[model samples]
Target: MEELEAELAQLSGKLELARESLKRLRITRETVTEVLAEMEPEMPVVAVDAGPPRSGERVVSAYAGAERRVIGVLTVPNWQPGMMPDVLPSAYRDIVEVVADAPGPIRAKQIVPRIGLPAETGKIEGTRAKLKRLVERGWLDEEAPGLWACSPSSTACSGSCCG
Candidate 1:
C-alpha cells in the first residue's frame, strides 16, 4: 500500500509540473497569433474523407487533447446533402465548406457574407448556431471567440488557422 501511494504521489507531481508549464506558456491571444503568422503566413488546410467510419480510425474529429465525441455522422468534402441523410446541419455545412476551401483561417465575418444568408446555408441565426455547436463539438476551435478553425489532432479537421 505504501509503495502504491508513493507511486501515485510521484505521478501527481509530474502532472502538476505539466499544468504549471501550460499556465506559463498561455499568452495574450494577439501576441501568439502574430508569432504564428510570422512563422507561417500561409495557413494550413484540413480535408475530410468520404466514407463510412472504420474501426480504430480516428474519431470523427479530434481537438486540443480530447477525441471529439462523435455525436453525429461526420462531414467530408464533395458531400452533396442528398447523398447522406445525416449531412451536417445546413449553415454549418456551408460554413465548413467555406472554411475548408479558404486559403486560410477566414474570419467568421468574412465567410458569413460570402456564403450569404437564409438560403442554402439558412438564416444568420441558423448559421451562427451551427458554428457554435460545431466548435463545442470540437469540429472547430474558438480561436478568438467568434473566430474558429480546425484543430491540430483533428481527423476530419486540420490547419493552423487563428484570427
Candidate 2:
C-alpha cells in the first residue's frame, strides 16, 4: 500500500508539471501573434523614390490588401482605373481594361461588345480563349465557366477571390 501511494504521488507531480508547460506554450503563442499584428504596415502609403523625395519626383502610391509585401517597384503603362495593362498584346490588354472597370464578374460575351470586337462566333471564341490565358497569367480570375474578373494583384482590384 505504501509503494502504490508513492507512485501515485509521483504521477500527480508529473501531471502538474505538464500542465504548467502547456500554459506557458499557449501564452507564448498568443504573444507571438500579438507581436506580428503590431509589426504589420498600414495600408495605402505613397512613397516617393527620387534619391530622397526631391521637389518634383512623382509620388507613387501602393497598397497591400493582405500580408503580401512590396519587394520592388513595378512600372506599367496606364495603371489607373480602366488601365493596369502590363506589357501584353493589345487584344489581351483590352480584355484586362474591360474587366477592371466592371462592377462585378463579367462574362466573355459581355466583354466582346464593350471592347468593340465583333459579336461573331469567331470573335466570341477568341475572347474566351484570351480570358483563359489571362487566368493562367495571374492577371484575371475565372470565377466560373465563361465568367471573369480582374485578379487581386491587378491594380485597383482587391480581395482574395473574384472582385
Candidate 3:
C-alpha cells in the first residue's frame, strides 16, 4: 500500500508539470497572434466559397488571435463604385487620424491624450464609441480587443494629392 501511495504522488507531480507547460504554450500562442496582427497592414482578405454570385466582393472578417480560423463570405451591400466618405465628422476624423499615424494598433486609452481629451474625464468612452462605429463602416479594423487601427483604404486617402 505504501508503494502505491508513492506512485500516486509522482503522477500528481507530473500532472502539475504538464499543466504548467500548457499555460506557457497558451501565452506564447497569444503573443504570436498579436504580433501577426500588428504586422498586417490591412485586414487579412481570404477567398471564401459559398452561395450564388453576389454583387460585392467577399471579405474575411475574423478578429485577431482567433483559436480556430472562422472563414465566412460576407457580401457587401450597395456595391457602390465610390463608397468612401467625402467628409468625416470632426470627432471621427480625429480618431481616424490618430489610428492612421500609429505604427500599429492603438488602444483607446492611448488615443485619449493624443486627441487632447482628458484621460480621467470619462471621455474615453466617446473615443471607443466612434471606433466601433468606424469599424462597422469599414474605415477601421479592431486588430485586437480595445486596439484600433486604420483600414488600408483610409491610409491610402492620406497620400492622395487632393487639393
Candidate 4:
C-alpha cells in the first residue's frame, strides 16, 4: 500500500509538469499568431477570373505599399477547370507531382523522402498538413485515414503523370 501511494504521488507530479508544459506551448502559439497577424500585409480584395490574365497566371497584390506578385497564398485554392499545378508554390507543386506519380494512395511518411524532406516527425506532420489542405481544396483526395492520393479531377492527375 505504501509503494502504491508513492507511485501515485510521482505520477501526480509528472502530470502537473505535463500540464504546465502544455500551457506554455499554448501561450507560445498564441503569441506567435498575434505577431504574425501584425506582420502580414493587408491585401485588397481582388476579383478572381477577371479574364485579363490567362489561367495559371500569378496574381499581383499590394504589399507594404508596393505592388508584388503573390504566387501562392498560404491557403490552397479549389482546383478549377484549366487550372494547372504551376499555380501552386514550388513545395505544393512538388507534392502534387509526387502524389500524381504515385502508384496508389500514399502516406505522409512515404511522401516525405520522395519530396527531399528528411523523414522526421515534424516534416512528416507538416507534409500531412499540406496533404490535408490539398484535399480540402479539391487538389487531392484522402482515400483513408492518413492515406492520400491525387484527385481524379485534378489536371495533375489527369495529365501525362497518370499515364
Instruction: Score every model by TM-score.
Output: 0.37, 0.44, 0.44, 0.56
1 or 2, greater by TM-score = 2
Off by over 4 Å in 2: 1-84, 156-163
lDDT ranking from best candidate downward: 4, 2, 3, 1
For candidate 1, what is the lDDT? 0.51
Q: Pick by lDDT: which candidate is best?
A: 4
| Winner by lDDT between candidate 2 and candidate 1 | 2
Q: Could you tell me how far off, in angstroms, the CA of residue 51 lies in candidate 1 after the best superposition?
A: 32
lDDT of 2: 0.63
> lDDT of each model, Cα atoms only?
0.51, 0.63, 0.61, 0.73
Q: Best-fitting candidate, measured by TM-score?
A: 4
Each prediction's RMSD over C-alphas, in Å, is 17.8, 15.7, 14.0, 13.4
- In model 1, where do residues sit more than 4 Å from their true spots? 1-87, 118-125, 158-163
Q: Which residue pairs of candidate 1 clash?
A: 118-122, 118-123
Candidate 2 lDDT over residue span 72-133, tens digit each? 33322323444335455567767887887799899888999989988888889989987887
lDDT tens digits by residue: candidate 4, 1-163: 9999999999999999999998897676556444444543432222233335444334344333433333223545678877677666678888998988889999999999999999999999999999998998889999999999988888868876445
